[model samples]
Target: MRNHYLVIFILGLLLSGCVTVQLPGGKVTSAKDVEYKQPAGAFKEIASADADKSWISANTGNTISYFSECGGKSEPTLKDLENDAFAALNESKTLSSEEVNYNERAARQSRASGKLDGVPVELALIVFQKNGCNYTLTYGGLAKSFSAEAAAFEEFKNNFKAP
Candidate 1:
């Protein structure tokens, strides 16, 4: 009887592993084929478990991170993601925001300034969705030199390609 119960439990586990989990838009095994040209400058890849790719400027402290989330049962809208982005910062306010086309899809670009660890920081965020995955690009640096970093971020943002 004990062996029979063990066999049943093993079968259940095997079946569960075989079961496919589908996302809202579709099934996405991983975020692949998304491409973007790195900004021209001394940028280095940084380690980030949460981000698919991340970079930091050797010249400036500016950093950029890109990530995608597999759609859930109810994927959040761009506005929702944008609001969440600002809310993640301390005392952040939108400086400007506009809709832009990104890889032929509607995308939102936002600029803001906020405090990080009590230090003033400037932020830029672009959010869009494609192929059952939501993509986000975040750029941030010290508020004082943010303008200088903006061009690099723009270059990176403009060259983004969705797979």
Candidate 2:
């Protein structure tokens, strides 16, 4: 009887070790595959100082919008834009100004360590304002799986225009 009990205990341990934790929706998929479809009329281009040079693109998926003001008297320099972007992130409780990269002009990069929807999440905000234009990029997702989203964020930034 003792041997039988020991065998059962060993089997329980082995089964426990093999157990895998699964989310409620079965196997989890990539956030990129989740399709962050922008709403109809979600983004509109408004004219800036230059013809189609300054504009703002609204990203509803991430609950944020990007504005680029190039070739205008109000056009913000890289430093000013970075400060504004960091401030915005802080407003959303996504990141703190000190946690993000503030000095880098070419790519002001910063990460906010936190969680969203019970998943480990990191928010990365990148701002690049130059030549009378400012670009604000933001992405949030699993901390370990941010590369793809980060690239998408950069692409969105690159598509900035003056309205």
Local distance difference test values of all predictions, in order: 0.67, 0.37
lDDT per residue as tens, model 1, 1-163 = 3433233222212211212346556654446787788767867776665567777666665777776666455567888767766765678878999998886788888988876656677778888888777777887776776677678878888788878
Poorly placed runs, candidate 2 (over 4 Å): 1-65, 74-77, 90-105, 113-122, 141-148, 154-163
Per-prediction tally of clashes: 0, 10
TM for every model, in the order presented, reads: 0.79, 0.35
58-81: candidate 2 lDDT, tens digit per residue: 332222233333333454444555
Top candidate on lDDT is 1
Clashing residue pairs for model 1: none
True-structure RMSD for candidate 2: 20.4
TM-score of 1: 0.79
